[model samples]
Target: MPGTPYFSPRLILGAAAMFGMLLALGIHILGQRFGLDLGDLWGTPNGIIPATAAIAWWLIAAVAFVGGYVTASLLFSAASGHLPRRLQHALIAGGLLLLIAAGQAASGPSPVPTLHGFYNGIVALMLGAAMAFAGAHFALARH
Candidate 1:
């Protein structure tokens, strides 16, 4: 383990922040232009926003994953070669999700997350992992 290469928290957190900002900006633009409510419109049986919102979220997720993978690759110096490529990417994506969970913990009004909120977070984070997996495939191709 002494020789094992790993990504730093600074690397993961910084990249996630940058990508998260991109997502926030995108959602902001969507909310401003279309006035779609993220909280209200998303879960209903008949959602208010078109499926395009889902597409947009997917695209943003891919971008975030790409950012994460690229950040890790840059910092870890393709020294990651010895590590299983899938494992390395999974670490990066998992780091991002944990960061998101920490963020959610800090932001929500309730001291403790409600059950529904926790459930939704799990679903959202899983979707993120899937997106990151796809992005990992794309990034590996470029590698």
Candidate 2:
């Protein structure tokens, strides 16, 4: 195993990020195609995308699904294939960061909504990462 390459966490993070972004952007595009513009979602005076919004939850779920997949896949591929506590924690942290970064585009286009967008993104990241790590932990526990 000395010369062998391990399952790279960086790759896992990238995969999760890509998956989350594609999902979020796809939803945005879908809304556009349906003639639902930004005005429909955040045209109000507050101009804030609420974390409780369907889009927010959708993005959160996407990150969670992707994060769990990547985490479990790497854990399953490890040489020992044993789930260590520290490894699990580290993977969860990585998943959190990946989800947050992937949601960077979630901060809507306008200045007013940008703040709320970032906040919603953070909320989504936290929930998504937790869901992902929990899923991976439970799944790996059975392995």
Q: Give the TM-score of candidate 2.
A: 0.42
Q: Candidate 1: deviation at residue 117, Å?
A: 1.2
lDDT of 2 by residue, 13-68 (tens): 44444444443443433333333333334445687765435554554466566556
Clash count in backbone of candidate 2: 0
What TM-score would every model get versus the actual structure?
A: 0.42, 0.42
lDDT of 2: 0.50
Span of ten consecutive residues with least summed lDDT in model 2? 31-40
Where model 1 places Cα greater than 4 Å from the true spot, the runs are 1-42, 45-47, 50-56, 75-113
Clashes of each: 0, 0
Quote the lDDT for 139 in model 2: 44
